[model samples]
Target: MAPKAKQRRILVKLVSTALTGFFYTTTRPRLGEKLAMMKYDPMVKKHVLFTEGKIK
Candidate 1:
């Protein structure tokens, strides 16, 4: 059998819908899945639901 994948964290970008501000974070997706999280956007000055989207 093949060895397990090494744990690795990569940088990701999350953007706010209201202010269009971007937040940078890291995530480890071993199975190759997108990361979705609800975090606080400082520019918006509130909590918002941010999903995995293209940075460019």
Candidate 2:
């Protein structure tokens, strides 16, 4: 018997800060995970920081 590994790859959403609630899924590492990234939004036509957390 062997222990199961935690999910190494996961689908996370990058949310827009413009309050448009626009989001898209991205692949990320689940181990020691702390993800904060800027992504482009078509509605706002600008980049916003998307953080990893329980979706609000």
Candidate 3:
């Protein structure tokens, strides 16, 4: 592909990612929350146990 076309494609991809991030934060925030929960649920349990031990 030509350099100009490649640059345009990259720009389009960047815009698409930005729009998706905006929509996730504004319209579908629960999706981000669920993702966060999934990512952290395991660590949260471990953290709680570690903190409880530290208090002893």
Spell out the clash pairs found in candidate 1.
none
Ranking by lDDT: 2, 1, 3
lDDT of 1 by residue, 1-56 (tens): 99996766555666565657566556655467777677887776877877666656
- The alpha-carbon lDDT assigned to residue 50 of candidate 2 equals 69
lDDT (CA) for every model shown? Answer: 0.67, 0.73, 0.19
Identify the runs in model 1 with alpha carbons over 4 angstroms from their true place: 1-9, 54-56
**Which numbered prediction scores highest in TM-score against the true structure?**
2
Candidate 2: where are CA atoms >4 Å away? 1-5, 53-56
Q: For candidate 3, lDDT tens digit of each residue in 7-41?
A: 21111111112122211111222223212111112
* Greater-TM-score candidate between 1 and 3: 1
Per-residue lDDT for 1-56 in model 2, tens only? Answer: 99987787777776666778788777787765767789887888888876665543
Clashing residue pairs found in predicted model 3: none
Positional deviation of residue 7's Cα in model 1 after best superposition, in angstroms: 6.9
What is the Cα-based lDDT of residue 7 in candidate 1? 67
